[model samples]
Target: MTRITSERHTDILNGYKSGGSRFNEWSREMLGDFTLLKWGWGALSMRWDIDDRFIMPDGVMFGGHIASVADHVAGLVAMTVLTDSKERFRTSRLETNYFRPLTAPVAMIEAKVTNASKTLIHVEADFVNGDEKLAVRINAVQVRRMTG
Candidate 1:
């Protein structure tokens, strides 16, 4: 596999950040670190604050937020390898497994692109709280529009 070069990837990431409204909005209002920390053509890593709005009444990060984060990460990962720039992939499926209670005040999510093809891409992620693993996930058979 060809590794993504830092300089070239940075360019793509800078462009991607401008369009990352779904996460930026959430980060600003909820996580407070809307500033993107890392990105490339095919991957991104981000952190969000565990503020009260994001936390459950039980003092854990809410499932809804975790799921949304997963969706964003997975979708973006799939988009990175697309051969078509004019079209976006649509999520055909997504599933998140809450392994342990995410009771910690802060959650960190890491998403990766597992496979990519002309028509399908698969992505996954894990949500961590300090040393604890809160979730393991696989999502979205993002289908690329085929062009002849």
Candidate 2:
């Protein structure tokens, strides 16, 4: 279990250059102003500064934004189990449950790979608010693929 620092994350991103500009940009947007707090074997923790743009008119974070963060982080956790440079994972199914409204200025996200097989990987993510309450939970399955 190795801690993934910000520099390590940058190295990993640079090592995996398969994703084109579109994918990279999308990931960046989903993880806006995020800090990698810690990471080990198949688990990672991150903190995201919630932007005012993501807040809805009712003053709560939008559900879609939450879902996107889960999906992106889940994929990153799945990548931790990859054994080959050609291996890639894509979310095939994602289910998100909102337990409470997210009005916090920041979000703490934790993602871990629960199970994995030759072709599929299961991941779970939790989004916690500033009050340390669970705001959202996400379960996802990622399909593994090989690239030439």
Candidate 3:
């Protein structure tokens, strides 16, 4: 299977530009169909409709899913920002904090790059619902892959 992790920056950036509209068919499949809400030079917002599979037994969204959303969306932002540099990246670290229960049926994620260097990049995200209630905060570090 062709994984998003293995794809080039141009392909991933194009996928993000179309925002779940089949610009990059692999990204739509890999992300399980995330809807692109917004995009800029170094940032992006995406959303996912909460389903029963994303809910925990306590009737809240699963924390792992929240983290995955942040990571995947943030990674896309990083890749888009670095597309011109011909660089690939991998998440070196990821952290998420839950502020309250995610009761909404949809998750709106906004991610942006905090800083970047030749070797490392930092990104953060706010996971909110339709009403703008904060559900989680995510911080991630991406390391540029040095390819021969």
Candidate 4:
């Protein structure tokens, strides 16, 4: 694991702030239209426009798609704590629980880092439907690594 200095952490966080809408091509392809609502030291919030493509034949958003979005947002929150560009993290454990079916065309995802260490980060995210009801919850553990 790479040691993250306080200065380095601040720099990385500032970079994220300046670089708005950090979604890459892969993220766009996977999740479609989304807006980064807020970002901080160990938290991230986003709003996504759920289209018909993500809906199941039963008229609810697919569970896998919700999980994917949760994973992506959790990863972004974890990256804010990284000190080095060479340092990377992978989701070692990801658990998602669906509280209710998502029938709305919009979703609000909020992810926050519960705990972070040199080697691991624990994050939790909530998926809320347009009705402001909890639709799904995700808990994830990301393992950090240093690469040359």
TM-score to true structure, per model: 0.71, 0.82, 0.78, 0.84
The full ranking of all candidates by TM-score, starting with the best, is 4, 2, 3, 1
For model 1, how does the per-residue alpha-carbon lDDT over 1-148 read when each residue is reduced to its tens digit? 5444334334445655774655466546653443345665566675645556666777767677777666766775665665443546778778988777665455666667777766778887676766656555555577777534
Report the Cα lDDT for candidate 1.
Answer: 0.62
Estimate, for each residue in 21-139, the C-alpha lDDT of model 4 and write its tens digit.
Answer: 34444566777566667777778888888888788988998888888888887888888777776778999999999999887588888889999988999999998999999989999
Q: Which regions of candidate 1 are displaced past 4 Å?
A: 1-12, 15-23, 26-35, 132-134, 146-148
lDDT, residue 24, candidate 2? 54
RMSD of 2: 4.9
lDDT (CA) per prediction:
0.62, 0.78, 0.72, 0.79
Better of 1 and 3 by TM-score: 3
Q: Is candidate 1 or candidate 2 better by TM-score?
A: 2
Supply the TM-score for candidate 3. Answer: 0.78
Ranking by lDDT: 4, 2, 3, 1
Q: Which stretches of candidate 2 lie over 4 Å from their true place?
A: 1-10, 13-31
TM-score of 1: 0.71
Q: Candidate 2 residues 27-92, lDDT tens each?
A: 557545566676666788888788887898888998988888788888878877776667777899
lDDT of 3 at 1: 22
